[model samples]
Target: MSRSVAGPEIERLIQLMARLPGLGPRSARRAALHLIKKRETLLGPLSDAMRVAAERVVVCRSCGNVDTSDPCTICTDAKRDPSLIVVVEDVSDLWALERSGAVPGRYHVLGGVLSPLDGVRPEHLNIEGLVSRASEPGVGEIILALNATVDGQTTAHYVTERLSHLPLKITRLAHGVPVGGELDYLDEGTLSAAIRSRTAF
Candidate 1:
């Protein structure tokens, strides 16, 4: 089998799309072709949306979640409990927790876990922000909703160690999180079970 050169512009689009998570060269090419076929409906709008999002999206000042504004809607929501904050590794995990509707507390997105192999370190994440949040006046507990991977557990332990001085009760999600599984992939039932059965660290 042979593939034709998709011209420079299409090739550029394919390259950019291929860089996205879960998108390979073949998938990127297919998506690019689809976009080209429906340029008015899909490609043009997608290009404009991506440009706008790139310009406006910024990290939430409080929780590090990606938002169009500095203090994201979740961080500014007055109805959320200040006494309980769920710590997650990334925005996707935070969104997963929200979808489950298990915790009503605020969230602190760590940006990512500590993965030494990938050159991710404690300082690279929002560990200091988490520790500071734990020591804040109203915080009583911190639910570590990180993934169940080795790196996730290691990051959790590191966070726990950093906040040992704070009075807040530290807890980890229960074993409903499958070994090497991310929070985003778990079902609502499984996520609920994990939260309910969360043990003290």
Candidate 2:
């Protein structure tokens, strides 16, 4: 059995922080100590922010982006082009595209790719919502901006099949993405190039 070096509250904080992406046990401990050192300056503010986020953050109804609003800021932007909808595998991919500033349009997040091996299926994703959005007026193009993985490609193909009957063009990102690269890990230049060089699917 492991002995606690700190109180239960501090140990609990470390455990929860360790669960965050890119954070391990040692890193979480370091972070917790840092936060404790800066209790009034950082820890308090961070706790308040996290509380607000936990209480108010929501999944966007239109694009599946996590935000404080139902449609999200991207979906509600009137200046964005309604004719173009960039379909991504997750909200992380949507944020990556937004960081590139290459897409002047809205987005549709699929939540995840089709991974039959992992039991993920079409019904598990937001595909039905995407289909309904594509059928709406002013939606002229669908850009499948998914990662370059087997599951991503499979999801793209499935999405293409579903949207094939619509009176709109379907396109995909260029080969700037490596065979197994994810959008979130890519730099802005590569993502921008991929978006600019997208071709018909």
- For candidate 2, lDDT tens digit of each residue in 1-201? 146899999999999998999999899999999999999999999999999999999999988999999989989999999999999998889988999999999999999999999999999999999999999999999999998789999999999999999999999987677768999999897789789877799
What lDDT would candidate 2 get against the real structure? 0.93
lDDT of each: 0.89, 0.93
Clashing pairs in 2: none
| Candidate 1 error regions (>4 Å) | 1-4, 177-201
Candidate 1 TM-score, C-alpha based: 0.84
TM-score of each: 0.84, 0.86
Q: Which window of ten consecutive residues has the lowest lDDT sum in model 1? A: 1-10
